[model samples]
Target chain A: MNITSDMIYGYTDGMILCCLSEQDSYGYAINNFILEKSGFKYELKEATLYTTFRRLEKQGHVTSYWGNESSGPRRRYYSITQEGRAYLKQRIREWKEIRQLMDAFFIDKKEEETET
Target chain B: MNMEEKIILYINRAFAGSPAAEKTEEAKEALCADLLEKYRGLIEKGHSPEAAYQATISGIGDIFELVDSVTGENREKALPSSSKILPAAESFQKWGPAAVCGIFFLLWLIRFYLAPGLLFASGLPTFLLGAVLGALGMRAFLHRNRLSFAPLLPKEQRPYQLVWGGCGLLFLAALFSRRLNPALWLIPAGAVALHQVISAWIAFSASRKEEDFHE
Candidate 1:
């Protein structure tokens, strides 16, 4: 089944933080990387991506500076702050716990039922 | 229009009345660059120009939410002329003196026409004028105190105080000159009516501009 946007909405902030954790990147680069990494299976709207960037910046989890792109318009690049790293660490731990709980409730139970 | 022009026009329409603050301008410039890159990539991938344009436009999603994030919740400072009802405290700050003056003027009129002897003995008209001036002075003092502590008023809105101050002066002049003829009172009354009309015209034009931008 294809994943719906609703399924990924809650993780957008974490996903963005992960992107910034790798290197300082502009809007187009981050979105393109996500698209390539997902095999073009997922794409986010420009509006949503920018909104998240503003929110994260406001929360002190990210900082931005304009890139010296000589051609066309200058790009605003975002880098994760130390607080962003701490937050991402917490989110990853929580995500792992939830994944483990889901496996216990679904995969293990399904295997047991099949064996019986 | 070219693809770049089309995208810029669309963005301008979306953010018409938003402030051109430095941070906001940076975000907008960044979005424009990204969208242009995406459009170029689509064209390189053999999409028809029309299809590419449509794709780029659709990729923006609901832009109002994005603008809101840039403006934040404290939009009053960013958009002073935005159609927003004043908070109760601010409303009182603006209208309280006018209300007090209005009541006193009404009382003076009733007494002058219906109880002439008592009106003369008590000098009710003079008393009303004094009360109006006193209320206005107190308001000014309070406003000055507030300014020392906080930047409460927007620059664009300060002209309203001048409008009211001129009306108050006209009222006192009319009251003092009423001995020439009872009709002298109409001068101040006419000034009040003129002030209301001017205020309404300003509000109407502002709202029309807001609508034009949104459209």
Candidate 2:
């Protein structure tokens, strides 16, 4: 089976935090950014995206406002707060450590065993 | 129908039967706008309208979680409103009367087995004790259910209340049993058994009501 969305839901907040850290953007733009960044290999469910937006806003990690669009739908735009940036940095550092540990434990061990 | 109208129809179906609220309405609007933008993006890439609509609808995943977050309805359902009663106090309120009732019955058992004809050996006090505990238990049970906004113990529960009240009076009669045969210890014991039966009935009915609520 394919890797389901739930498997990576934990990283969604971090992804959104990173996306918003670049600049203030609306729902579609942020989702599009994630889609393009993943080389169209993945896209978020709209429900998950908005749910993360609400949760992040609740946690003081992001703030949202209605964009003043004269025509069509007025989009709700979100920006990373200073707190969100700090949180994102912390998560990145933790993830890097975890990644290196996993590589040493699994990848390096497996390569060594195969060689021996 | 046009793309926008098709999307709206799909959204309506998705949110069908959800409670109408300001927050939910806002979420619906935001979701509609986001999906519309996505559908258009898909369309621009040369997908047919039907394919775009199918893709857009499927990409929505489960929308109820979003609804639950925005409305906070699920949170309220999952937890008792802390503002109304502290968790520790609420738990105490729920179990205190039953515990007291159990203790009184336990004391009566010890009295009957360990010491016959001891102080207050007629077991009249036992009946009165059961009556008072029965009343207290009823009040506490009703209060706990009320905290969760359960419908007032409906007409069906009336029979249980009446039976419980009858248990109280039986114990009240035990208060006078000292003037008669002491073998009437059997009366207090019977009333205690009836009290347990009534409590079990109430508990069973309460659990049934909760099942109905979940359904």
Candidate 3:
């Protein structure tokens, strides 16, 4: 299924936190992973990603530092903080609850339609 | 332009009016690096150079929104914990003319008391000439310091204009009162000095509150 940007809007922060949870990463690397993992079905806007990074950093959900690359311009690497981990866990639990609630309603609706 | 140049150009254009502080420049550099990396990756993945460029540029989404976010972040980071007084040079430039006028008025007062006959003979002319010079200096000072006034009244305390205008009227009144009582000349000078002090205090406090609010 093609995932729309709207579908991922609310979960962008959680996704970034999850990505950083694995290891510290830069903007392009995190986005590349997201794109590849989703089989190229999702590509985030650069502006949105950077804006999210700034917001997350400001909110103390992540911390960033300049990476020492031997060649080319320096990269900004972001790592999830303890607060980010806690926030991600809370968001995951909330997401699960929302999914369960939606599934129950949709499944009941589908069964009723099929019966009719 | 080359990919790196194009990326730098785009980012710079986006953040044109923003303060060129170290953190802001670092952020711009980071963004340029990321975009260039994305472009190179696309080209390596067998995409044509033109297609890669298109993809990378399109991925930037709304440049204005990104600029707003980045600029807002910079502003928050740059907000001072306390308001800084205007620089010595600027403060002097702003107040020097008024001080000159006060001195001239005092000189006029001294002449009036010391040599009553010489008051209009030479004192009036000297005071008038000083007043003209002071007026010209004040006009230039105000013109130069207009932008520096923005932080002083972020909420728009405009009544200061009326206070200043009243001070001018008082000075005129004092000038006319020379016939009745030359000592009355001190009244306008005192009034102007009080107005200057009060207005400066108000501006300083307003600016401090503005800084505190941002903090």
Highest lDDT, which number? 3
TM-score of chain A of 1: 0.89
DockQ, each predicted model: 0.69, 0.62, 0.56
Cand 2, B chain, TM: 0.39
TM-score of each: 0.65, 0.58, 0.60
Q: Residue B64 in model 3: shift from native, Å? A: 1.9
Per-residue lDDT tens digits for candidate 1, residues A1-116, read 56567888888889889999999998888988887877888888889999899889989999998888788888889999999999999999999999999998899889999999
Could you tell me how far off, in angstroms, the CA of residue A99 lies in candidate 1 after the best superposition? 0.8
> How should the candidates be ordered by DockQ, best one leading?
1, 2, 3
How would you class the docking of model 3? medium
Q: Write candidate 1's Cα lDDT for B3-54 as tens digits.
A: 6778877887787667567656776788889988888999999998889989
Q: Show the colliding residue pairs in model 1.
A: none
Q: Write the per-residue lDDT of candidate 2 for residues A1-116, one digit (tens) a residue.
A: 34468777689999989889889998888889988887777788888998999889889999988788787666888989999999999999989998898897899889989999
**Model 2 per-residue lDDT at B60:** 85
* lDDT value for model 3: 0.79
Displacement of residue B97 (Cα, Å) in model 3 is 19
The residue ranges of model 1 lying beyond 4 angstroms of the native Cα positions read A108-116, B73-142, B145-215
Clashing pairs in 3: none
Recovered native contacts, candidate 2:
0.73
